[model samples]
Target: MKKQKIFALILPVIALGGLLTLNALKADPPSKSKPAVAGLTVPTGFDINVIADKLGSARHLVITPQNDIYVHMASTRVSKGIVVLHEEGGKTTIKTSFANYGGTGIAMGGGYLYASDKSGVFRYKLDANNQVTNPENPDRIVTGLVSVDWHQPKAITLDNDGNVYVNIGAPSNICDELDKNRTGCPLLDSAAGIWQFRTDKLNQSYKEGVHYAWGLRNVVGITWNQQLNQLFVMQHGRDNLHQMHPKLFTEKQSAELPAECMFAIKKGDNAGWPYVYYDWQKQKNMLGPEYGGDGVKPADAKYINPVVGFPGHLAPDGLLFYTGNQFPERYKNGAFIAFHGSWNRAPEPQAGYFVVFQPFKNGKPDGKWEVFADGFAGTEELKAQGRAEHRPTGLAQGPDGSLYITDDNKGTIYKVTYKK
Candidate 1:
């Protein structure tokens, strides 16, 4: 009977897949508003400004001490992958862009700007002014990382200890279909985890780097928390629960069961993907159906629980720990997450398309998370249709303690300031 039910759903699944792909590729109409803070919602005493716009697929960003901005472009208007900007007297202008390839991972450390394409990590020397001096002849630090068509972005961060961490996201969702016996997922050998590499090393490969952590399905938002002296990551939850395991989950249950989790990780922590998923409602890690259990069963004791679990499918693309003094004392040590929004959750009102703040106390989550800034999707109707005006993809902090957010949908760079 189970086999018959599964066989009956294959054609419908294929048709749905086609429709979803079409909807995803459909371009949204241009937004009409031109004001800096127009169509946005923020807390009192805070204001948002559009410092720059029309950048193509700006994913992650870094601000230098001089307040020079460097942004990674997954796609570009010109041939360059990194876009540089300079601000003076409250005005921002594009300085220049360089690099022959495009990607989503970029960081600055030790007078060098590090960037990654799909297959490798490269670094370029920076001048005294924090501008890339050798953009065309970057030194390849790490090479030969696995990258597929999806989940290919190697979101990166550097620690004060001269180490760089890169997230190699898992290609498969559940791996049930790939490893039919469910004994193990072969992809875990290289993907689905964070890998640590020395910032000073050159021409390093998978064998040269240490596998920092495993079992996280995919992590786009990653940071090294200086206060905690640990690595923190936001995991994107698995999708298609109802479509793949209809017997165990309803449509609503599928949309909301698994939680997008935040983990303050150590050297060998595992968050349990494919084998388990955190159910935010239960506040427990439930065994994945792919691993021969119903949704209610608890995951193995070896897997670590998340520091915080948010609603599923929020697609957290960026994470930044606030250490600036521009905001109130309450926000000094908190964390900000950029939700790129959700495409699934259909048959239910789609959600996300906002930034949220999670306060921290003594290097851990302190209180409930709150929406820090919202209305990126423009309207309820556009959000439901999965056509957003702007989707926040990256977060950065300026030298003067202002927060910067990047929109990948329409390429808008927002500067958020607090005036007390």
Candidate 2:
């Protein structure tokens, strides 16, 4: 009877082992899926390949000197703020949550990657293999940046001296107090402008550096021109062209008013926000209705004028001064700006959903601006129902002298290189 009991127990143990072996054989290893196409159309000489996609609102991108692409992805649910993409043999591996904060800005300067969220800025150190292993805990480079209804994603740029410039957007449209459309009721106060800060230090308050430039309503795109050794920005003009003040501005006047400005910024420069507007139709800067000047005059000499102006509300988001030698000779030392396009320019079709090139000669605009790449706005049908496949928001240059453009609407990055 003891032998019978032993046999029964041995049988159960052998059966159990066999079952476990069968289950192990049934399980399969994880399979790799094919990468999806980005669905972007480019010119004949260029190709739009997706480095990364399906990220949560990938706003801005910057590449390191070693050819690694770092994307700042803003989150609404999961805060995977920054994502680093390493590409090898046409395969991309993504390392996410590189930073604790994420906003609409990412820049590489001083041998480190810097990013800004709604609150503050942070830095990271990349190794020789272009891998960011030690991401420093965030240091508030600048605080008290307005985070109200308007002006949320303050874009950031760095100068050669390691000074960081953050675009602090104004909270209100025209700083209107009563919301009743009165002239000169709201004034240009301390709240509406860009603020500069030092990147080498932490916890620097708004009062540390000078309030770099005033009267800039919302300069979203800021970059330092390495060729010129100067800072440049693309301004988002005031809204509600004729809806806010009808008596002062006609529909045609309102449609073509508020010239989007590109400024070569300097210390103590004021671009005149609430005090004046640039009228493209008149080809002159005019005083703002709030300041009681008619709509057909030149801007005040006390205020600095824009180096170049664009149509109203094109929403320039990405600006880059090309220093690469891969493209044609004319592209060298020039600027490429990506307009995010217009939303309020209704009754008239929306414009500026493409990349534009402005030639520069001797540190200034040498020729008229032209559309460098088109077909971003796929169709012209009003009230059509389809997703805007992409909206260009960031610009970066690859180590091979190719240009990289990123779209926020769909998280796709395109590397553009010249053929032949």
Candidate 3:
């Protein structure tokens, strides 16, 4: 069955073997009413400003040295797919839009702008201005990736080397087996892992990608730490902990069972999802419900551990290893994660609709994670997922040591800067 599935994934390469066809973005319509940044609260020296608003489905964003913004829209009502904003005179104006498909991966590297949809990955050659030279069509870099409704965001990151890493996220809850431990996963060969392709290569398929790392389950947020020269990924832990294993975990435990993890990935490294999940409360990796060990048993010694663990169901959306000299000296080399907010933490108030800063010393976490930016939801308490006024979606560091965050809910971009 696995062999047949693999073959089915590859047979479509011939049909999509060329540059992707795109519809150029129309000029951004006038902003009748922009969101106010007064609701946001940052550090003492920092101020947040709402730069852009009314962007539909703004999922991921990449900022250029010129301070221009490129946003990948998962679904849009005003524009096509990817929208570009040109920054000038303390204002960001919509310049153009390109690409027809909508999904969550966008990155700039090696003079190219890379973006992915549900299934395939594409790149456009960037001109000296850091703008796409050809917005109508782009080189199809990788094709034939799995694109089911589950775990199919295709979040991407590129190392300093020529490698481009794409997440082939797992489509099912724990690989389709709920009641028992399933070894080898069988799905490992097709999904639940990061596939490494070449930034310099074109028209490559899944068969061409090297399975760089596995057992990640779903990785929506990923970044390459240039200082440490390593790839770091944020894994969204498995959900429905108590509903799946009622005998062992309560609803509260289910809401916070497995830890949303941050991992420093190396070749052949695995975080042991499905069979196990890291328990932040226990400070150890515990066997998973499907694996027959309840929630407290220790996982096999063979699996690796997380570098940092966050509470369950935070839905961490973006990760950045702060390399720029922006902000205070303490922020240098730290990790900033944007939690898009949680939906499954029912019975307990939904948390994590803000950005967090985790300080690091010599490439490892040095202190407890702290909320760097808050008030995104605009309410004192969160009753449910979409109840928040704004949901933080993406994170970007600007050219001049500033942090730029995106809100997919209201399509607002907030620029945070510090002054002495």
Candidate 4:
């Protein structure tokens, strides 16, 4: 009977795959609106400004040395692909819009703008003026990436060593029980964790110098921490906490069991997913169900532990390490993470619709974290109505040491700065 049910589910997915051929589509241009500037109350010296609004699903952004902004806007019901915004004279001009290719990640390094589509990673050279004069041409840096339902975002970041790290999310919620009441582990035989590739190569497969770290579930936010000189990622935790194993978790436990994690990654390190999790309140490591122990204590000494843990399912989409002198000195060398908010913790009011700051000292967290910015949810009435004006997805720093944040749900980008 279980086999029959599994077969029934597989048939629809196969049919859908046949029906919808994957192709890049052009995204709609930004809607015209008054250049709006709304201020957000931060610390005693900081100021926030609304830079651009009414964009269509703005996901990630990277600023060039010239201060031009290249924003990756996801296609919506009417539009298809990527858009580049050039900033000049206190105004943003649409430099180019490519309707042919689409993906969620974008980065700029080595005088080239790199983007990832459903198929693979591509790179294009930007002129000194920060314009992509050549759109028809892009070097396929990495190819053969899977773009299925579960692990499709393909968030990426580049290290100073010219290595591009891409997160290939796990395709399963705990790998689907082998049998009812049984737990499964990560499938490292295929796509499950972070894969590294050289930025200069084209169409390079994962089998090259591309394997970095393993056992991460979905590390959407990846950045090279300049202060630490290491790779850091914010991981989305596994879901269906209590429903998967009723014997181990209650509904409340499932809703708030595992924590969304911030991991400091090194080559060949395994921050165990489907096997271990960092318990925040308890301030210790805990075993996952797949390896046999209850969700109480750390299971293995071999797995790497997360540097910090957050509330579960807040959907951390962007992370940035502060290196500017604009804000207070305490913000220097600290990290900023944008939580896109919760979708699964339904019966209980959802959480994490804000940005958080974690101070760093000598490549490690110095003390407790704090909410750096809030009120993106708009109003309590709106939240009760199941509607939010924005969901923060991306983070970027401007040339003048100001910070910018993008919201995917409402298609807006905000610039945060300091006044005193």
Strongest candidate by lDDT:
1
Higher-TM-score candidate of 2 and 4: 4
Q: Model 4: residues >4 Å from true position, as ranges?
A: 1-41, 76-80, 178-186, 384-386
So what's the TM-score on candidate 2? 0.84
- Winning model by TM-score: 1
Error of 3 at 267 (Å): 0.9
**Per-prediction tally of clashes:** 0, 1, 1, 5
Instruction: Please write out the lDDT profile of model 4 over residues 1-420, one tens digit for every residue.
Output: 010100000000011223221121223333334333222335555555555555568888988767666778765442345655555555554544564665578888887788887657888888877666566877888888767776787888888888888888877767645334545453664566888899988778867745789888888788999877899999898887677678887887777758889999999988777677667668667777666757775758888888988877888999999998778788888999999888787566777777888988988989888888776776665544446677888998888778888888856677777777
> How high is the lDDT of residue 6 in model 2?
9
Q: In candidate 2, what are the lDDT values of residues 56-118, reduced to their tens digit?
A: 567778776655678787653433577666555555545444555658888876656778877
lDDT per residue for candidate 1 within 1-420, as digits (tens), equals: 011100000001011223222123232322334453346877777777777766668899999998888999886453268877777676665666677777888888899999988877998899998888897799999899998977988999999988889999988888777798899999899999999999898999999999999999999999989898899999999999999989999999987868999999999998888899999999999989888779878999999999999998989999999999999999988999999999888778788999999999999899899999887788789988788888999999999899999998767788888878
The alpha-carbon deviation from the true structure for residue 288 of candidate 3, after best TM-score superposition, in angstroms, is 0.9
TM-scores for every candidate against the unseen true structure: 0.91, 0.84, 0.90, 0.87
Superposed model 2: Cα runs more than 4 Å off:
1-44, 76-79, 178-190, 382-387
Every model's Cα RMSD, please?
A: 10.7, 13.8, 9.8, 10.4
TM-score, cand. 3: 0.90
Ranking by TM-score: 1, 3, 4, 2
What candidate 3 gets wrong by more than 4 Å, as runs, is 1-37, 178-181, 382-386
Q: Is candidate 2 or candidate 4 better by lDDT?
A: 4
Rank order by lDDT, top first?
A: 1, 3, 4, 2
